[model samples]
Target: MDTRTVFLNACNEIANRLDGFKILEKGQRLKKSSLDKDIYFEIYFQSSFRNDSSSILILPHINIYSKILKKWQIEQIKNEYSQGLIFGNQIGYLTPYNNWKEWNLAGLSYEKSINEITENIQQYLFPIFEIFNSKETAIDFLKSNGTKFNQWSEDSISPLDFLLCFSENETAEAFLNNFVNHCPYKGNILKLYEKLKTQNEIDLNYSEFHGADKIKLAFIKGLKII
Candidate 1:
């Protein structure tokens, strides 16, 4: 089968597995929207040409909208862009599709490719939905699993970032505080540390420094100033 046929079949299988979700196919991209329309997962079949060969790759992107968090994000984006935030915050992850060349060179079959796509959805994509479905579920998931700070990225805020922004739950608060305390930075890191500890929301304006500062502040918060 051709790449397009295989890609569409894989998308159909994924949509079927998701039940109430709807899939919108636009050329080589398939967007999966949640039943309530508040969440979206974009799957892209990216084609690249190199040397004398061409290959198809898959990519996944997520957009989540929570009524509770939208206002804060809107205010932050307005303050940052002056045009306001038009879309919900979105994130993407590394997937097996990124390594399509390895599979293709290994003579991976179309059926096996579909199975790999399904496994990727189950292992990586669905967990994100489970964590972000609601503020309550998100907090519960964080409390139980702890914040996935290692997954922090500059492009988008993870579930842990969302919890830090809006959740006043004791578990969330303590986790942030503890995370800050255990960091390795010292001296000037206190300013950012105190800001994180005292602020109710992370300023999107400072997002460039957000990821680095989180690690630094976590380590330097309580150190004595020289």
Candidate 2:
């Protein structure tokens, strides 16, 4: 299968299986004129691009906890598995070579467009794949697991902080919205929470949240913060 074909097929599978999720894969050429000078394109062959050619499915909402709570969540997930944080669901990329290629091409004249697209695809799919290896099983697990908020005052910096530090404008906003809705500290612990809520700049739903463990693990993995 071709690279575009692989991404398309993977997106289709993810959409069909995962609930409340959407697929984002485009098999089109991005215009260089509209992009920054640092972006470029790369060729992908079906067989040789073993690690380079892959798919990811993101949960978007699985990373819905405050910074401090996220730290505790990581510890909890770690205790359950004998394997360290790098193994199992917390794994970041397909392999070492793939990650090396990504980092090497992150910001350059020949990496602007394709690299950006590749990065976005990776972000969207990996977490979803981890959470929902099997659609029914994932849904069932989410239902059984559920999301819960924990104290937000334990640590000064958190997973949310890390995501915000690295994420793009809109992505950071979405993550902050999730935190506003799911973080549990009250009164004075979280000054940011109060500011975000009172400002009403973000769309936060006051529903029963779930997946304390997954949310925490994801934040810990992505943020690289305890």
Candidate 3:
């Protein structure tokens, strides 16, 4: 099945099983932080249970444009107030393809965070990965099925690029560090810090700061790249 078809089906199935669920538009505005003025199209689904507002599932989608349209898109992204949305926060996940390769997970707002949505898709999507055990196989799946992605320059890198094959402690540590360095919101930093700490005992490699005690993990979040 096509990845989009797979995704849409999974979402529709979820709506069918779960009461008060609704899938909204393909694009909508999302604000990352109060101080950060950039708006993102993260709210792709809205649920009546959540008061008819979107809880975005940020999947990767390739945007093709004519010369004039491309210029407009770049200009909009470059605005001083426009902060580029990072992975995990806004966009969720995608089926591995040459074109849309950065993310593959669905995201929920702080208000509508639900594991059921993320967990349900695993059963539907994981089997597709089983058929092709290699990275190339994954790419072939995307190239053949992902029409929008195929149009772009095939020079893009996949999520497998940064993922270290060896699951060493240092490898995980480095991954966490890079994640924090690129995060735009303090809330996410804290959430990831707690997640890391719960999963393993990691020393906070940062100095003290005011108001950090409230979050407890803030010290860890403030770690410098020393």
lDDT of candidate 2 over 32-129, digit per residue (tens)? 11022221111121112333333322211112212332353345443432221111111123222223232211123223433443454355434434
> For residues 1-226, could you state the per-residue lDDT of candidate 3 as single tens digits?
4344434544454445433223443222221111112212222332222222222233423111122223432453233432232212112233223232222223334313334444423432333323223434433443333212223222121221112221333433444444334435546546644565564544322223322221233223343221
Best by TM-score: 1
Query: What is the TM-score of each predicted model, taking all chains together?
Result: 0.55, 0.21, 0.21
Give one clash count per candidate, in the order shown: 2, 14, 6
Q: Rate the local accuracy (lDDT) of all candidates.
A: 0.46, 0.30, 0.31
RMSD of 1: 7.2
Q: Give the residue spans of candidate 2 off by over 4 A.
A: 26-157, 160-226
Candidates in descending TM-score order: 1, 3, 2
Off by over 4 Å in 3: 1-46, 49-166, 185-225
So what's the TM-score on candidate 3?
0.21
Scored by lDDT, the top model is 1
Q: Sum up the clashes in candidate 3.
A: 6
